[model samples]
Target: MTDSLAIDAAETVDGRDQERGSDFARLSRRIVQAGLLERRHGYYALRLGLVAVCFVGGWAAFFAVGDSWYQLLVAIFLSLVFAQVALVAHDLAHRQVFRSRRSSEIAGLVAGNLSIGMSYGWWMDKHTRHHANPNHEDHDPDVAPDVLIWSVEQAAVSRGLSRFLGPRQAFLFFPLLTLEGFNLHVASFRALSRPSLRNRGLETALLVVHVAAYLAALFAVLSPGKAVVFLLLHQAIFGVYLGCTFAPNHKGMPMLRGAERLDFLRRQVLTSRNVSGGRVVDTVLGGLNYQIEHHLFPSMPMPNLRRAQPIVRAYCEELGIDYLESGLFSSYAQALRHLHEVGAPLRARGSVADPASSK
Candidate 1:
């Protein structure tokens, strides 16, 4: 394995690299020939229609149920519905549903800011950086040390909540994710202060309207106590659902160290792990189960990703690059194991676990 990696590194040197500039070009040609790059307008239309029906139906049910505990069930249903809306917003952000940026952003604002109360502009900037460098410790915001440490170096310097959670993070990961929805809301509101965010006025207005309308609906129908419970439960379920959907994509994959570079194909392929499943998994994850394919072709329509998978896998195999895929549960286990390993040292010392000690 070490020798193969050494050979891979050597092949990447001096611009003579077989897979540097030309490899992705070739793969892209194959993908285009397969017609996988074409937009799936019909698919998006059907999907958006179903999503709208669910969204409207969920709210209608919420009103019909009134101030009862049964509303919690409605909350669960709506959380799932909201997640689907966010997925549509994700496709819009990637331009998978629209050819023009203006069209995509207009749809994105409605799906994100108005429908979901997430700031599309803020998420786009962050998501773009993540796609540019999927698992780079320095560059990918998704992998950066925060409430949970992703690397030994990060574990060593861990402070505050991260330090407290490091040793037990794997166990607590899902529980912590219950707060992810709330965190996203806070981050969206906070990002309005950043001067780099475009359409600041429009973004703020949409978000404010969403919050005001959502709160008013809850309080007007349910008692204050039930409304608060409904709000917290809905957001918590949404957070957990979103986190679970994304965590399996790159969490346990190889992390690119400082200044380590690869051609675009290897950069994305080596750092992503796909979850193998059928249509149900595809729907649940919004096509993110095909993480490798999606990373390789960010603009590819979600429905087209499955068709592109075999072509991509065969090409990677031909080039002697690893293409990782695992069963859905196996992927989660790998991610949790990685979390456990990263905190091994702190667990031993009764301080923060040292990510290196597990090695």
Candidate 2:
């Protein structure tokens, strides 16, 4: 699956397999000439070292705090650390840090399965589809009919919990994300039974180690009640943090429908959004704030995404494309507004139905 994804990524270069005068081919030439796709081993080495220290130090503090309620503070800190670790895993899966598949997968396994208890294979497969067709309702799992519906068409046919949640999802979005961490763990374990997942034995072993160690550490240091609370708090924070980091990238951007064919440049630029921010925002969002550039060149180094922004934006303007970049809070607002609009039909239906039947 990683190899396949790499193949998909490679097709972006000089717009291979594309016709002459391809817009993406021209853009690719500029990006290549600007040296945006080069590997950044030094930056990654320092980054990985710092993250390793923080991860280990956070746990050391957790044990040091012993049975104190102050351990809750440690839980919050660790959850933030875990999100950062997951971001590292994201880069690894993109092969941004490592040029070789073997090296990337090895580090991805450590960062994803062992450290975070999420399946690298599972996430890679899903993310690969997302990149291949960003914001396509039919193809992008991110916008598929899940607990929250992303389109009115999906909402119109929603049933069971999805139906119940659809109308209020905008209001409930953040609260629901509190469980996203747990959902990821459950999804990872469940996906292990699938026949297509690579390295099944090793992935399972790493995941089991992560789960066992995580639970044992909590219970060994604190009472059962306190341990449970710490676990919940940690997972909740992790979920919300992770959700926030990703939600701004494409939530309110254009949605591609079935049979809608677009050139590579338009498909990526039109459906993706950029969040306007500086270095701190870049770090917090894991450089995903530059969504347009990242989707265009998935394997581009994170720091280089920042530098490539101006060139990409100018090129989009030259082509008369509506490049969307929004302030952080405005982006969230736009996403929530889109969610609300998606559920308008459900809201109207409920309002006109018999009151008792509605309950």
Candidate 3:
């Protein structure tokens, strides 16, 4: 293994100007063409089973415990499962989770829309734009304007509020910013619902299906208030899971773009960093700690992330790429203070046009 990695490393050094992206493309084609994409059927079964146990199990726990305290616990568990659902749905979007296109499409509708309140077209389109221009100041759709940054007037108003309510807000606010519908999807959903929409009918139908399913489940099980509580608890879990996580990657730092042509791809790889305290945190975070890998190899399955880590690092390191990284808690802690950090004039003054700028 070491010998092979050494050769790959040497190849990376000489292949700097050799257009090895195409080489890797051809190489991958050969490998996958040799009966790799034709997957056995068992992976789909396991995926279905896990999805069922996670989503259904959360609702079951809510009724099974019947305690107010347990509601929060079930919500937390469900939130984790939902995070997994996001990751899995992402896998489905890229055609990694399910081998069959039909299976992938159907599963994506269920997991993406019904499970997560995201229409497949809406989420996939944004994700596609994200990959096309990650961290690009001009193009990457995911590089949306942040609400964290405050103008001078706003900062003045927030000074007292931040001190008095910052910690409390941190406790509850992290979940609010990153969940599917609340913060992340607000802009996205609005765009999807526009009159000039591309797939408005299909996407709206999916959105309706998800809302109707949630409402039906709520009405069938308990009173309306309890159903609302269930929904709130559910959103809260995902909020924290996504809020802390999604924030860490791009908040504290500036979005950088590379040269022309490879502009966004370079920004993504150079600007993204991997957090590594250990395997425990990495697994829980769905290997999102490996953010650079996730960005560069978006189609790669989440589980194959750790496997590709060393290769990705070696290649980028040889190319003088800037890979931002910190420990598990430190990255998130930095994220917690991101709005403040970026709010500072010193940090905010310089535009993030270059991918090399780091605080």
Q: Which number leads on TM-score?
A: 2
lDDT of each: 0.88, 0.90, 0.59
lDDT of 1 by residue, 243-320 (tens): 999999999899887989989889999999999989999999999999998888788899999999999999999999
Residue 313 of model 2 has an lDDT of 95
- Give the C-alpha miss distance for residue 266 in model 3, angstroms: 3.5
Model 3 lDDT per residue over 272-325, tens place: 767886777765676678787666555555566666677656655766766677
Between 1 and 3, whose TM-score is larger?
Answer: 1
Using lDDT as the measure, the top candidate is: 2
Clashes of each: 5, 0, 2
Per-residue alpha-carbon lDDT of model 2 for 76-152, expressed as tens digits? Answer: 99999999999999999988998888999999999999998999999999999998888898999999887989988
Task: Write down the RMSD of candidate 3 (Cα, Å).
Answer: 9.1
Candidate 1 Cα outliers beyond 4 Å, as residue runs: 1-20, 351-359
Lowest-lDDT window of 10 residues in candidate 3? 1-10
